[model samples]
Target chain A: MIALYTALITGAIMAGLQAASAAPPGGEFPSKVPVPADNPMTPRKIHLGKQLYFDPRLSLSGDVSCDTCHNVAGNGSDGLPLSFGVLGRVDRPRHAPTVFNSAFNTVQFWDGRAKSLEDQAKGPLLNPIEMGMPSSGAIVKRLAGIPGYRREFARVFGGKTPITFEHVVQAIATYERTLVTPDSPYDRYLKGDKNALDKSAKQGMHEVSDLGCASCHAGAMFDNPGLPMGTGWFRKFPMIPTNPTCATYVREYHLADDPGRFDVTHKQSDEHVFKVPSLRNVAVLAPYFQNGSVGSLRTAVRVMAACQLGKTLTGLQTTNIVAFLNSLTGKFPVETMPHLPETPDSTSMMQVAKLQQNQRQLN
Target chain B: MIALYTALITGAIMAGLQAASAAPPGGEFPSKVPVPADNPMTPRKIHLGKQLYFDPRLSLSGDVSCDTCHNVAGNGSDGLPLSFGVLGRVDRPRHAPTVFNSAFNTVQFWDGRAKSLEDQAKGPLLNPIEMGMPSSGAIVKRLAGIPGYRREFARVFGGKTPITFEHVVQAIATYERTLVTPDSPYDRYLKGDKNALDKSAKQGMHEVSDLGCASCHAGAMFDNPGLPMGTGWFRKFPMIPTNPTCATYVREYHLADDPGRFDVTHKQSDEHVFKVPSLRNVAVLAPYFQNGSVGSLRTAVRVMAACQLGKTLTGLQTTNIVAFLNSLTGKFPVETMPHLPETPDSTSMMQVAKLQQNQRQLN
Candidate 1:
């Protein structure tokens, strides 16, 4: 059932992607985000997705959720350098990217391993270091057992067989798509509101282009928007790094340990190459970069200048760039915590006991 | 500054407690719950508390929150046998009691250690196996550093020093006091609506009284309301030991491991003595008892009858009782997730990194 649903959605997504690709880039940011035909947003689906996103039952320990790391309240990131997973059992290899404005991104994750938001949602559930559900089958069984979720799935899917892993991801992806943070000061300035930006921020915006920052961090999203959604536009970090700032960051931050896109493709050329992250709400979300190694935005700016562009920025220039970055802090949507539905049986209890038993066996 | 505020509030709480104790216990369950005069509910304070309640930043791993255990979505309990704490690092010694209708309880926790909800909120933050903050000072410093929180504190507290451990707990408790699960079928029945309860439920209600089940589980809240808030009314679990079912439950569930109120009082008589939890919403919150050992309501009903009353109920009686319990489920208030404020500095990052380092060293 899930395979059929996935295939059906995939075909619809591919067609939508083609249509999205034909549209010219570098225009005013659309208020309405592009939605795939198959997984079109509905009130019920979004509500269910919100519940699932906040629910920790997705994890083995029943203590980790999508919001555990990508907190909607705290600039869509957990505000941790490395995310703490179930029972703080393992530190996630990379920093949790902000979910705010993620809908605008061409691809998901620092590695771009997952293609769409739907694809991205599935990775964390089964990742042993993340949510850590033993299998998709286990998740399906657990969710299906819950009476409230059964009703919801039936209502949303309108089928005899409603609950599936594919539908779960689709609902989650639909919710993720709604997480776009629109109407930032930068966005207002782009829309011909000259006075929207401060003097320093205005100067810094022009300076960013002059410094070649806009070459990659282009378009309304400040990511390479020309690339199709769920497609990577990889760039080599520390491209020309001989500076003391860049060298110190690499060593101290444990950046070398993660091979970036190389971990996904297993290609030498992909080494150190990562998808350009959207600069939206970047000021509030720090320690900067893939590893979350740098502590301050000013330090991150100085290092990025040396490593990526090889142009040493002055203290004043760094300060202005930071101000400009701060202007990207868009208005966040009000996200109320949804009251989740309860299970009628001991399925949750039995599942938890099984998980605890597995943990005991491992120990 | 915090000391001054605490002293002032303490005086007010004392006065309120005096008034509360003087009031007769068995009035038509007061539609309005008495609020502590000191930590009175304000829109700002309740809003702040709601945010704090859902915020995982309260946890050491930055993963767990009050909502993690007392989920508003699922009858206020996490629906787990043993509530998972920081990183699933340690299994909580007892099942997490539901936050719903908790304000009506005379005491907090299964052990009945904390007096008021304000007192209860502080336990998890410093508990090694719970939220696991290193110290109270650490929590204060973290919240103080966040500019938005600082402003909110100043607004809510109306003082130069707004961010304190006392204020944090006070706000959380104030919000918790509002989590009253009123308007249940049982509540309506209690208010003289004869048809409020179903035929089975009405029969079960009579059966419960006949079985002397209402001795401890008494009053409007289904807890002993004659006692003042925070005062313990302890009853020995598994009062009778001869039954094979009771013996098996004790052995299989490791029920003896948790010393119950004995751990708090160090009195031999306190052994296996737990606070009588309210029957409100009990049907939906399964895996019954302190150990969460019994998965089904039927099993729990049988165990409770054999152990507490020394009377094994028939299958029909148990089903009817379960129906009666289901009638206790109440309407939950629409609780939306709050957008938490961000820290202006890397204080959160530094703290989490320090905690991770400490964990590594301890391991």
Candidate 2:
């Protein structure tokens, strides 16, 4: 074991270090992600969740859809600094984070307000600023009004809890778990094919550790390992002094006023301590940071370097970081994504309700 | 040439007469279909149109998408005598037509009310019972509101016409033209490859001719070579003594209220003079006739035989006709259809306007 001690330090450092930038270039993704026995993933639930995602009826204005912000083909995030919510086309307080790998977060949201992905899924629906659904009961009522959803929910979650916010969240959460990014260049490099990463990408990865980003984004999930609320890695991100709401941070071009964990806990120490987001597909996801205050990948690295590590990154270092980030963009999963439903079901209860509503109004 | 002298009158009739059930197959699909220059077919336009065809936005209730009744998969028609429309959850008025080769229609729709596929495309959107859009203007407004849609329409249609109803129809018509069903076993059999079709299917095809179903459903595109509206044969269909609305056939379950062609023209001669729908893929497109009163392919054939040929079909004939109809079922081009715009601009704009309106009220 002691034949060559040159590997000792590297092994020790690498043992607990996350392989975030180390995955196969082109590998098969799991046909399906596993779910807890308590919440099984059925085609019915996924189908229901997909409908909910696309259904504008879920929003208060009957306009905002989940797919509006998290476009499946548009690299998950809607390529905006911040997403627009209901009431008006007002920008959200924070960036619209990618839905990918969200299942791994023990606590969801930048502030870790929600305890699980299910809880997180439910948050936007009830948020007056987002979907503006009157309440979870209202959401259930709307969903129940659609007969197909009712039938599907009954089939998947059992006939008992036919319609509930909990069921909706659970179904959505199950679907969310399947949104993992897979088979990036980093992954290929890690699987023993060293040529997967170009020279610059490898150099950039070395700089990632040197810059201390690994301190927070640490694990296969690229998030702090399931540390809830007060227990996780904590660091105060920079904030402008004068903001009364203390709600978000502001940079030169973009606004960065995400109070992060502070808004949820109201603890002084929690102020600006945002949950570290995964860097997978970070190259495509611009307007980085909790508030999306950083417009570019390189600038985001710079901000993180200056604000968290108290060091300004060199221009080359920033470019290298971006190059490394590009390595994390995963393979597009075409096979596992569900086929479009063969036909639009006219008999769907949602259709029935809409028809009834139209008839009644006309009469 | 002297080729005409070798054919005797009796010999000519026997040799020239093709089975009505069987069409000349084993030929390549025509490359040019006389598209108007303004709406030329390109790979991009067809691709975009296909997506729009399958998308549900064409419907008002957010259910009953285009593919609902005209099934692109599952043999190109919803296996129903009459397919439901918006609010027609339990009962449908007319049989959903097979879209396999609807592009060949000289005048589209069962009534021949529309002069072209483009005109036919607009029918459903404006029909109160079909898509149920408030107005063509509303549809244009809705589509124009979506950024992705704007981009796509601009790309496909040369420029944005503010996403007018015309654009929608044209796009759909363009897509529908590309849906020609591919070569079937019958086509190969017709190519002098006698072994292509099974003994039973070929035998059934001969029976189809003897029964005279091909008198109307004829040629490469089917229907009359000259008259697109009338059945292309000499024999008149049986009529009810009570009304000329039965000019073509005596049938129960006639929506006597809907005089197919008569409603469009207000002409007595047009009464019951429904366009002769090609029987290709009729096996899959069940619930036949202007009013989809017939439930099965066998029933449809029997009804046609009894009314047109003045002969009551035996169970054996019905089965044989069904076999022949099944021969028409073949492969259809399938690719990813267009998705509804995630951030529909009209919806978004309406949302913003509503917000402003609400804010003003609040103030």
Candidate 3:
């Protein structure tokens, strides 16, 4: 009887620990992301990807690079309503979403246009309105011309074509996967840190679960890349059977207009439903929603409530939800970008050239 | 006699070892600066100084500050025939001298008018043509209003009351003195570092002593504050006794016209002579004469040779001398200026009302 009682007590204690640590229904996320077989994650690829992400020379203007939009200093997104790209000061059509925990998305892009980060990476580089490199060939030639880059490319890519668009995309994707949002107050509170989150955040999180936001955004990686042991393939996130919120999209499954995954797959059932975004550091990233219709977090919650739960949240409840969203923010590494060489063939060069020109004019 | 020979051999070997370990004569400097006493270096302060140095807040029209002409990043002097101050484009009459070793000077300003750095600090703040604050009292009142500055000022210079002009000057002076040059190749060579300098720098340094440049520019803190142990109390620098090549002024005991020392004493014999400027980093500091009549190091050397030595430097010799001047470019401690509050209600408010007004209009 004593041994049996001890066993029962130990089981109860383990359950209690689980209750404390498990994401309070809403904050639960996937454990891992699905990676394509061709471009496997490697240390070399990650290193190269990090370098490419920071190199401003990748852009045609050499100024409005990826860093201009997704500033590491300002929690991924540049805290702007929409990004300013290439030569134009005019705002972009969509908000620059945070790349903090994007790896586990069932599909990338607000429209669910791309299947993987590798697929997503290629879209931006070729989006003439973005980096505005004339052509991939031109970019390759330019990179090849830089002797340091030529040597580095050879070392990283294992004698593969040093200047291919595919290699570039693969490297960038590898780097993106490494950018996981680590332990936040939400995670810590789950992991026995009772005081990690305040009353407001905890209350907001409970509301988030009640509203069924966790149905689509679930587990460690947030979005469902699909059932781990069952099917390895990518599907529209928030599997309909599991999430009642997904039922709304089921009626419009047959509709042909930008049928989210159906466009990529041609399957009638895979329609309209898109990957849910991670809420990590979501408080700081402004201009919410796929079309950036919602500017404030409170408004975003209300819209989601109306769309997903078919219920309107009170103003105080919305404020609490926003506070919870803020609690999900993760600590970021504070490393600086490498001191890249100041090329004489650029701004300083032009200044020097102008001086020379003025001298000629004087003579 | 045997012991003396052994000592000489050991000294020679140590000197050789030092020369082998030394760094190259001159190159680019490190991005960050070191801090010193009465002023602990911090990123916030340095950032503030960088902004202030670049900012026109100190000017009447918000178009000029200390950095308007004396560009700190560009070897602490503007590369111009003469520096501009009041008006954005108006060039000031005299060549803005390099501020590299100004901290070590016994007296400051072109005429040796200021006794100490503390005395020299407020001159530009209220100089109608320079920073142009109305009065010392106005500046203090302005600073007293800024809330952010109040805390910083209290911490940096004790409680706010009697936070007079002296604190302002002292803080700035403290910041300036810490701008000591880093270990140069020569310094390393002295310390027994091999390969610290190249063959050219070594050959050039030998020529530096031969050309009599060291007469005025002497010791680690180059410009002689006053060689009390050597010559009389004070002597005009770069001007040797009995130099017939001096075309502008003649001196029996002292130059009669400029009367460098006489300006203070009204002694006609002490006229037309100025304290010699330091030649450390002279290669980078252009517009080299007191009046900035000479533009380059080579030109300055030639002018000095003709005037002081009654000998004209050959083209190669002038090049060699400039190379030697290049050798003197030592490592300087780069410090970040602590951020003092700029707001009117802050503890350490800077007196920049006109600048604030201009900024508001721009915004």
Candidate 4:
């Protein structure tokens, strides 16, 4: 029995390796960032964004920030299925995805709701349950009231009355672009250092291609297959749900709980179709899928095989796929936590009427 | 009328300056940290503690870390009346104090319940409403399961079964000791750079002395007049609450809400008694007082004078004191955000029985 298992695994590894060698593998992440012509990257703007990203003053509760949900400090995720928002509201619809390498995505968010990173930045701040600002104007007003922020906006953006909702999102998205992590072991292996991956990981890397996982998770980001920016390469999760294995897993995890992209587009064809989430750093960002129902990466791998590909994975296959996914974990950039700029001796909370702010916002 | 007001202000400044000039001024923060003999400072332990500080896995909700409430990136205090804890519990009775310079604090917490920083570190993580670990054993179990944390703990605290709750707090407290912010404009002034503080700030400094604010807010930290470490300087918040003005203000702000130290000590004398909190970075830490009732620093200063000293200040006194407090806002040290350690292909959340963790924890 042991000899039969080893022979089958070896045959699978050889077949997978043959498929991987058919192409030059043009999935290397672009070293140069594609800057929006209107908004060039600047040190001052990045610095401004860092402060705004960490500042809770953006939230109505003054407890949540951009970092609260999409925390760049960790794996760019808060690790919860749905992050708690202002006043501790835990009704956030989806698991917060990692902000790392979000720039490489053709579109931001699971549903591909926002076309660009800048548009995605504004959604949570006004989401009532998320950052919970009443309106974009209210957020802008709070930023403008602070003299330091006002000066920073003017300096970074360089215009009369520059502390706009537009500028805030631009700065934040620009800062987020700097959050991409590179230099994973997978990249080293791709760069011709064969010894970068131990035996099992190499087998898993080839199996990922053989199992058709790379069709969606294609490229250095594992998000797109040479698509233009804003053109999301989306695919239906649980693509082969009619298969008995797929149907059984779907019913168990409630894979149909969310309508996915159908909610965004209100199109029947878009139902259950979600953006191909980057497999980069997927090992650390567990509790997988749209609903974050899956916790272990191995289970996610097994579920993907049975539900999406309609193949029941053997124990060896499951272990190997998990190993390859683990190789996606990359070196994170060191970031200095910012000292959020404060108005001297006063705060935006103080600007509100006396006991009303305490009643409305505080405990 | 203007001349008369100016003359009075000049006289007050001169009197305050006379009091300040009388002493050698022993309030400058000590340049070196006084490490406890048992938990000597090391780069490795500090590094380990930092990972623990930023890791949300320590929290039952997998959201709140040490940095969530006491965010070192901003003013150590989360600028809210009470910080929202794990699962967004906002029932925290008192405002979270700034973690900056907390090492110099005689005792931790508003009521001085914890005797040392190490003792205080364990409080929030286990508090049902705060970080909300089920128990110390559960937290230790969670940490031990993470291989990266296990290796780090073993390296930092050299013994078998190194991942103890005790060592966790020790490392955190040791890291907290390094959180001290030293060179503010006030510190620079104390270092004989008279010009570091502008003219208005200088006048405010002197008035702080004249108003007897220096009596309690004494020395470099403005916490105590040389109390030995571990001995808290307790004082009645509304020292002269019987004063009609003080009584009226108290009723409006609900200053008598929580029976401060009495809850811990259960002694009549300890009723409404709180540790004299350090005024190190008081300028940025707004929404002042125990309940965070007063939003403006001017209002807080006025309330302190009326409630504590039975003195009503002129407008100029409030403005000048606010300026002086602004000078206390110190230079924050740069901190790099950490990548929390993740187990190879598993997580503590996964170890919990399947869908039960999702039911208990996530949305």
Candidate 5:
């Protein structure tokens, strides 16, 4: 079974590689994002997923949702250096990546631990420091208990028993896949509209390739595609050891302690090796970098140049890059908050009882 | 100045009283909610307030916003018995009241501590257990520092300097006044639509007046107009001392310790007295009552009947009342999440520095 699963994944990666090769120069992003074969995107699934994304009942405290960290209003990021989770837990070690156009990425997370969006959706629910659901079983039980959710799951999946953890993650992933942001100024420029980008942004686009940023940020998503899906193309951050910019970030933001992918791989070479984040909508989504150390995009550009390329960019060069990055800000879809279904008496009555019991203990 | 302010307030109250008496039988809710003369609702102010309402930067933790608790999607309540506040503080003593139709209330808070929505808005910002901002000065400074907010405040207030605490509360209150839910089945019935309510609901509506429920729940907003605006019409909860339902609630939910209005007034008669809540959208906004002890609408009906009227209602009577309460579910305006303005580096860079300093101290 493991071998068969491996073969299927390998086949998918090969197909993705072929598609990558056919991509236009500077990597013209596809207008429509691809959906996984196992979980086909449907209106019912997407609707259900959207409700789930905004619903905080998935958390133990009932105060955090997927939208809590990746707010749909602000470029799919919380605009915090580190995100606050359930019950105002603010010690998150890494920055939340933008959910916009995240479907184009090979892997999810700064360390690329989760292979797919479906897989990534499950991590936060069970993570003690995140949404703080006791278990997958607990989440399933909670959803099953809520009559609205049970009905939604049944309608979406179309089965006698469809309220499962797998369906929950699948639906959420399907909704996320539809969050692809296209038609940015950069994208329009690639589509033969020369005037789409301003003069400064055009110059910065050329500088992007000239400065070897395209070597890694190569695809339509400005994401590395050489690596297989669910696998990361890890690059050692702060490659120039003597760079003052790197030293300052390490000292101030406490970035040196986090071993990046080495936490996942447990290998020396993987130390300081972090996943290359997509630069889509990077302008509005601040503070920058994995640790959220850099507050300003201009400063971030200078630091990236110094640490990654071992070159100090001129003030004009940094300004132009910042302008080009701003051009990547695409039109966000008008997302009205979904009216969540209420928990029925059978479920909520028990919840109230439990809540009372907890309250009593505290008092 | 105090006499002038008093005269102005008295005039407004008299006008409100006249309006209340002019309402038709069954108390038909007005189409347009009354706007306070001092803080007349303006499009620009409402727009700015909407952005601020959704922005988490107002909170000390940058997590909890007004929308976090009073979510527009779910009857303007979090659907939790007690709301979780900053840093997962779940010890909130009372249920979060629905923001919908709140403009109708004579006073704000269960204890009637705040006279207006403007006054109420200020309480949570500085409440150590709520949004947990250090001070109103801190919030003002934060808003003034943000270029977007500064520009918006200027535009809205039509002044060079507009980002004041008074303006902030005024804007928020103005936005909240617009949240009045009208045009329910009950309102339609009041407007001479004979067939608006079904037989059971019709019976319940008749019982509402016959059983003396309308004595407290009077006027177009189904609020007691005898009590002046921002003044409490305090009623002792669980009026029947020997009721089993009251005993169970007091024991289980710890309702006895709250001391409702007594906490504010510190008077013997005020003990256990609470501001009578509006029944608008009551069916959907559950678990019911201020303590949130009763989960089911039917159960709530029974408890209220026994506690307030000193009558143990039959199952049929309770069911009918529940049906009638369901008729109060009004048409909710489609509220799309407003696009919050981003804080420029001139503002956020300083915030980040402070955040890092705090984090360093914690570490």
Candidate 6:
């Protein structure tokens, strides 16, 4: 497909082909989202997952849902620098990453701690500050008591007592799988449409490719380049930390505050190593980097150029790259609000929350 | 329409008609919502309202939108008893009423402090424990900074400075005017469908109407009986506090704890007085009453019967009434998630929140 697309392109723009060829050539977004064989994608399961994703009852305070942070209403990530958890009780350290097209990521989470969307799904629910559901058994009991969910779980999974924590994550992962964004402007350009991007954006695309930005941000997703699942495409954020200009950004943004993948692996080599992030929707996703310290896309581009490539981009170069990044914004699918099911007689969501606490104590 | 539907019914059920005649006759939910003449409804305005309704930027925490509490996805009310404010720092005393069909109420809020939906819209934006926008000017300034919202407001309202506090409420109220729940089973029955309700529910319907529940829970909306806007249909909960059965409920649920209308009006007669709430989706709205003391619909019905009507209903009566209330569950319109407008370049929602705080302090 790449060869065919390349054949269609005029040779006049082949100045950066040598550099792009050394890196992986961009590919089209897959029409179908990849799903694990263990958790096959069924429409009912997806529907159930949508309900669960929107249902705030899963949280300790019963107000924060997956949509509360990674809201699908706009860019998947909430526009806030940091997302607040249940009842807005505690602040999460990192910005909640955009869930849009997250299924395509080889590993989930900024640290690449969770191998897949399923693993990522469970992390927040049990996380003390995020969803905060105490124990897995408590989640099962809490959901099972909701008459609407109980019936749904039975219908979807087709077994008695089907509302298990495993199925909960499974269903959510299935739903997240459907959140792929396709037909971005850059994609159209790669598909042989010369006019897809603005003149500046086209120049920026060539500039980035020639600068070897594609070496890390490769393939269609721009994060993982044909890496197997569980094999993280990890890269050190400040690749050229010794560079004078890079050291300035490192301090200003508190880039080294987090140990990154080292927090999970507990290894010196993994220090400051993080999953290569997708550039899709980066235009609207402001307050860039893991810590959400930077504010503008233009500034982020400049910072990245300095910190990673050890080259301070000129004003025109930064503008061009920003234009290029803006073209990655794609058409987001319409999110329809699902009718979440009702809890059993008279047991307010508050009581259920207390029940979770009690169950946690027992466990 | 009521007379026509009444004629369709057999004369066999005239036993309770005499008692019901003293109260308001049941009517079908109106196809249209009442809008103040001053604030006309428009599609563009409604669309803008939807964006604002879901935008968390209105809050001090920049995470609590109108939809955060009075969620329209399910019962319109969050299943929790009390809603938390910014950062979950404080708990609101009263239950956040369902926004569905709220436009039909003659007065807004449990205490009837706000005269109309437009007035109600303004209350939460600046309330320290709610949306927490500092002042009216701050709200205008906060919204004006967003480039997309600036464009949208200009298009919708058509002025150089279109993003005003008044216009914000106008758009939100206009959008809220569409949140009526119709085509309920009870509504179908009111439209002359004989089999719309089950036998038990039918019996329960007659029981409530004859028992004088209609005096307050009247008209198409079941909360205002042809009353002029701003004329609250206020009623004292636990009306006959002297009755032995009523005293038990009043004591157990702390029914008289709140000063209610007295809090707003400071009148002797207004003690424990509250605007009559609609029973439209009461089945799904658990943790009932102003304080959410009663958990189940059945228990709430029993409590209401005892406190308001001064009658200790039998289990069968409670069951029947609960079933009847369940039949009022209407077909909720599909809430389409609107693409909330993006904030300008690098301003994280967090920064906007801080601006609101500074504006508050300045005010």
| Cα lDDT tens digits for candidate 1, A174-255 | 8888887878887676555878889898777767867888777766667774555656877888676566767776677666
Q: Global CA lDDT of candidate 3, please?
A: 0.53
- Per-residue accuracy of model 1 over B1-363 as CA lDDT, tens digit each: 011212112223332444633321222344665566677788889999988997777877776789878887667888887776775654544778899878766678898998788889999988877888889998898787678888888999977788999999999988888887777887676555869888898778767767877777766666663565556888988787677767776677666667789989999999988998878788888878887777788778888887788887899999888888888888788876688877555657555775555544432
Worst 10 residues of 4 chain B by lDDT: B1-10
Write the residue-wise lDDT of candidate 5 on A278-358 in tens digits.
Answer: 777888777888877677788878778877887788888987888888888777777777778776353443364454345
Q: Poorest 10 consecutive residues of model 3 chain B by lDDT?
A: B1-10
Model 4 interface RMSD, in angstroms? 4.6
Off by over 4 Å in 4: A1-20, A24-26, A343-347, A350-363, B1-20, B24-26, B343-347, B350-363
Residue pairs with clashing backbones, model 4: B27-B219, B27-B220
Which pairs, if any, clash in model 1?
Answer: A87-B87, A87-B88, A88-B87, A106-A230, A336-B336, A336-B337, A337-B336, A337-B337, A340-B73, B106-B230
Q: What's model 6's overall lDDT?
A: 0.77
Full candidate order by DockQ, most accurate first: 6, 1, 4, 5, 2, 3
Clashing pairs in 5: A87-B87, A87-B88, B106-B230
Docking category of candidate 1: acceptable
Residues B1-363 of candidate 6: C-alpha lDDT, one tens digit per residue: 001122212222332444443322456666666667778788999999989988888887788889987898867887776676676644435778999988777789999999888889898888877888779998888788788988989999996679888899989988898887889998777656879999899888878887878777876667766666677898998688888887887787778888899999899999989999988888888878897767778778877887788888988888888888888888889988899877636463647434433323421
Q: Stretches of candidate 2 above 4 Å error?
A: A1-363, B1-34, B58-64, B80-92, B159-165, B226-257, B337-341, B344-363
Alpha carbon lDDT of residue A254, candidate 3?
Answer: 18
RMSD of 6: 5.6
Clashes of each: 10, 21, 53, 2, 3, 2
Stretches off by above 4 angstroms in model 5 are A1-25, A225-228, A344-363, B1-26, B192-195, B225-228, B346-363
Please provide, for model 2 over A136-158, each residue's C-alpha lDDT reduced to its tens digit, 9 standing for 90 to 100.
Answer: 88878766755556677788778
Q: Provide the lDDT at B274 for model 2.
A: 70
Interface Cα root-mean-square deviation for all models: 3.5, 10.7, 11.8, 4.6, 4.2, 7.7
Q: Specify the CAPRI tier of model 4.
A: acceptable
Give the alpha carbon lDDT tens digit for every residue of A309-351 in model 6: 8888888988888888888888898888888988747463656
TM-score of each: 0.89, 0.54, 0.51, 0.90, 0.88, 0.91
DockQ score for model 3: 0.04
